[model samples]
Target: MSDFSATGYQPVSVSDPEVAALVGQDLPEDAFREIRDILFTVKGFDLDSYKDRCIKRRIAARIRQLGFPHISGYVACLAAEPTEQLALLEALTIHVSQFFRNPTTFMVLEKKILPALLRTRPAGRELRLWSAGCAMGEEPYSLALLCDELCNSPEQITIYATDISNDILKKARQGRYEPHRVAEVPDSVLKRYFTLEEGFYRLNDRLRKRVRFFHNDILNDRPFHRVDLILCRNMLIYFSPPQQEHILKTFAAALVAGGYLVLGRSETMISETRELFECVNAAERIYRKKADDVKEDD
Candidate 1:
């Protein structure tokens, strides 16, 4: 029901049952193979093991609005042109992000975790953090603000924020925000960190320079550098269980021994991989990597 249409795309109609029926139709095994090819060619997302039903539901909603009822037609649309593929990929890859999305979790980071990380860091060392799936850059900027408040020189901290969407990454690097996006940001921090211009907020140079933005696919690529904390946030919810497990193992590999992993409020480690990470702040979904674990992929 949320307005999800992003640049040059129409919003999919959300009359529940109609959307359900279109998705409920039986899809051939070959249908997914075709889908994986189109997705990879167009958006570079490999959807081979991605849960078909969940994808079909999203596809059906888009198809219904576009007046196509059959999955074949949807595939045709994807094959017809590159633009359609871009639009479909934008819709398929979920981009629901907000400033300081989980306040309690952020509070724990600001009040406790960061201070502890700073204390144990070797002399004159800088902290490195990665905001995986950092859609539109709010989370990394928020971390920059926190680092500014916590560290004597915020420039000492470095945050790498990445997302698969080239479109979102462009917007993120611009560092501009709609006014409403800052609703949860504290007034003191807001005024200190951003300058208002033309009905939007622009992140100041200090905070902006501390964060670097890049394109990363968690499932396919190596994480950047050793990190003190990695904030993957809400992205795990959309992936299939096996995909989730694959990514978590990558996350564990990316972190230094005893480094932190943060997830969205609704996500948890798959039961099978519990031994790889131990919870630190259970309610905030904060975890620390197991010192004894080694990557099988390595």
Candidate 2:
């Protein structure tokens, strides 16, 4: 008998009794204090403000998978182990994303938001868009498709896609996807927008050139320039409240007057900071910056 409970169970080696017993334990007080300092030295982001329980579960998952004896050993491994550092980042970073992720949101943008913007775009000026924290390329690519549809010449629109993970950015830049991933794109649009290549569809160069991919930490990097719209979805859910507030303020500053902001369906602007934005589509999580704001925080 394996002595394992199947309904709520895992293998002994992968879930060693001692390690399972340690699940509820906090990272050693000193180790918790040191983690951010160490991670910042290597990864350039502070982890201290992340909710302890969230951090604990992620670290515990890693420890369990690797059969580490203690959080201290994991901390030491993070310092001395490059592979472990990458694994830690995988655990901490948000990777979940999809194309035309929420159909109604895209529907609203196409039906109302973009048409309104096109009506107002200054003559001879390009429409600029930024997809901050763009993951695996889906969201930004979807935006690119929208721009291509709306533009007189797709070349006139510029989309900047930025993410903290180099690995994910590389995948995004490739713009190749399994057929199932393109299911949301209507057949007509999919054929016109992408080309079949080696069992996958690749975003054509016209669309690819419209998007410029960059490795950027939204909290640390300079804001994208001449931004008419910014799409920063889902990525902020893991951030501390203060970080969220700072990012919203930063986004408000970055946006050109009347420029739109799109957040994940689950997110909302901090009401106390209402002076910076006016919700344009409350149900859709879209907002427009006040006319008075243009320059970003230094």
lDDT (C-alpha, whole model) for all candidates: 0.79, 0.78
Best model per lDDT: 1
Which lDDT tens digits does candidate 2 get at residues 111-212?
888778777889878888899999888888998888778766767778899998888999899998888778788899888988998899898877777789
Q: What is the TM-score of each candidate against the true structure?
A: 0.79, 0.81
lDDT accuracy of residue 33 in candidate 1: 72
In model 2, state the lDDT of residue 203: 87
Error of 1 at 99 (Å): 1.5
After TM-score superposition, the amount by which residue 76's alpha carbon in candidate 1 deviates from its true location, in angstroms, is 3.7
Per-residue alpha-carbon lDDT of candidate 1 for residues 1-298, written as tens digits (9 for 90 to 100): 5433543344345354443466464344565578778877655466654534577657656665566645676778778878877777777787667788888889999999899999998888888899999998999988888888888976668899999788999999988999778888889888888899999999888678888998887767777756889999988876767778888888887888888999988789995668899999889999998886845233
Structural RMSD, model 2: 5.6
